[model samples]
Target: MSTLVVRRAPITRVLRSELRMVLRRPRTLIGLGLLALVPVLMGIGIAIATANGEEGGAEGLAALVIGNGMLLPIFALSIAMAMLLPLTGAMLAADALAGESAHGTLRGMLMAPVGRGRLLAVKAFGVASVTLIAVLLMALTGIISGVLLLGGDGMLTASGTSLPFLDALGRVLITALYVTLQVWALAAVALAVSAFTEHPLIVVVVSLGLVIVSGVLAAIPALDWLDPVLVTTSWDAVSEVVRDPIEWGPLVEGGLRALCYLVIGGSIAYSRMLTRDG
Candidate 1:
């Protein structure tokens, strides 16, 4: 008598297939398209405001981006981190597992020769790819539109000094990377929630609900003690990048907080996947 051995698929092959599936989805394309357009619309609106002698009427980041195109990506990233990027992360994470489970495809994957851990890794890769792509798309569009509408100029630092183009560009890239990490943390939590339910909507709702609750908790002065534990509390640190001296304390703190969430969420999802029926 002989035992049969099933061959496991290569990781690259699995990851490639997963990415193709994710990138080809209509919803994915549509979501990314919308994300890309946001920065363009923002540039147009800023241009219009400036043309109307309303440049001084703008406030905060908007006021800074009035003529400095290099700041546009940073401005767009700030807005996205508040809500849009997190929402995208939740939706992609939900579709990664819950949507597949609802459509009966997850069982097939579970029964395959692939280990559950590897399956989770592949799903994560796909989700991360979508999230990263979404961010990059926004950044690219912001750059193009800002340069066209606002004029290519050095970024104005919070200290009222101007940075060289290369330096400003580097800062924008760093901001993008930092924002991506925050969204990844949220996606990890959504993945954990997705592991327990076949309803994609539940994953999105739960993930976003957590975000909203965190923001609200962080805003309350009495909850100062809780600020250390809330993810949203550290988000304001993103502005530190554009500061003249570049305050590293808050940025480092925020990155570490995000990593904690990533580890916790990934661990929970792995544990549930190990014991789940499919």
Candidate 2:
């Protein structure tokens, strides 16, 4: 009897393939379109609302329209991270494992000498890359629209203090990166859930449901103690950087949550795949 050995695909190849597969999908493009659309619509609506010398509402990120056009990216990112980003993340990640299974590619890939754990990690990374790109795109589009529609270079804090435009841009970049990190837990959860099922929709829906539940609970005064454990608590904390002597506590908390969820969820997904003989 004789046996032949085959080479496994390189991690880069796997990642590139995953990226192509994920990005080429109509759903992913649709999600990206929706994300980019939000800021444009927001900018136009705000422009109309404040047309003819009407006063801008000094409430939340909405007030950014009157402050600085660059600030609109931050506002757009805030909304995207809240629901749009996570939902898109869920869609991407939930499909990473189960979607392959749905398409009958999982078994073929496993037989390709690919390490199960590495495969899962690569898929997660690919999805993360898509999501990170989405965040950047949303921010860029928002900034461009804001610049053209709203038109300003000065910055304002929630408290109405003014800062140099350069300082504001730096904070916006920091906040965008920080928020990007915070939202990975949604992908992590979806990845974990994705391992056990062949049905991508179920994984997507359930992962999104869990995230929504966490967000809802975090809002209730009774669930205040659960903030540390919730995946979303630190997500919006990047806004803290907008303040002078920027607050570090919330960002730290959010970073820690993101780390914990990624490790725990990734571990479970890895273990589940490792055990499956398929």
Candidate 3:
């Protein structure tokens, strides 16, 4: 009987290694530090907007928080995706092959017992995991800052209705999830772009440019058809989630669109990574 040796490396181990590598980089640290400042600035802005006679009473504060907060999460998601998603994807994908090739470590790794497919799977998992963490952190910070600054006593709507605190909290959570899905779609695009470039900066710039172009195209009146096709177009779904009755249509449609993008992007990325001569 032939004995078979299964690859025993867990995805967590690969994720940890990737995380360590990311933390060791100065640019990664700077990006993280800048992300940490978003909530603080949001809180400060809220305070300024609500200060002394400008918006009197809890109702005014609530109005400002709810209407403004609805948009803030979306903006945070957009900014985070635009800036960090590409960097993370580059670190994961470009570094996975290019960095190893540059250091001549890929040859050694190829000689190891690990299968290329397994390596690629673990690398994708690590990239996705980091993207999720970044999204959660940004959402949590934005919510906390908004609630603290504007006071989460009662939810005020643009239509002038007040929802209970618990209801508002639920909406906030849902909005966060929506934003997360949108960001995930952006990360997938970055990963796809990363597979094309050996230079990390090139991957980052290309991914960012892709996102910007999608946004620009989606804005044009004649390009309405491209709106649903663009990955970044559904980024505004979080706002819809915050609205009354919590419209599920946009969220559902946006999620499905994102899923399509993820599938297509991941396929392209996987194909490139597997076929390349790194």
| Best-performing candidate as measured by lDDT | 1
Tens-digit per-residue lDDT, 104-202, candidate 2: 888787776677778877888888999898888888888788888988766677656776878877877777788778768778888888888889999
- Write down the worst ten-residue block by lDDT for model 3: 58-67
lDDT of 2 at 113: 68
Task: Evaluate all candidate structures by whole-model CA lDDT and list the values in order.
Answer: 0.90, 0.81, 0.64
- Kindly give the stretch of ten consecutive residues in candidate 1 with the minimal lDDT sum: 55-64
Give the runs in model 2 whose Cα sits over 4 Å from its true position: 1-5, 52-58
Candidate 1 deviant stretches above 4 angstroms = 1-5
RMSD for each model, in Å, please? Answer: 1.7, 2.4, 4.3
Could you give the candidate ranking by lDDT, starting with the highest? Answer: 1, 2, 3
Tens-place lDDT digits, model 1, residues 175-197: 98889999999999999999999
* Consecutive 10-residue window with the lowest summed lDDT within model 2: 56-65
Clashes of each: 0, 0, 0
Query: lDDT, candidate 3, residue 263?
Result: 88
Scored against the true structure, residue 102 in model 2 reaches a CA lDDT of 89
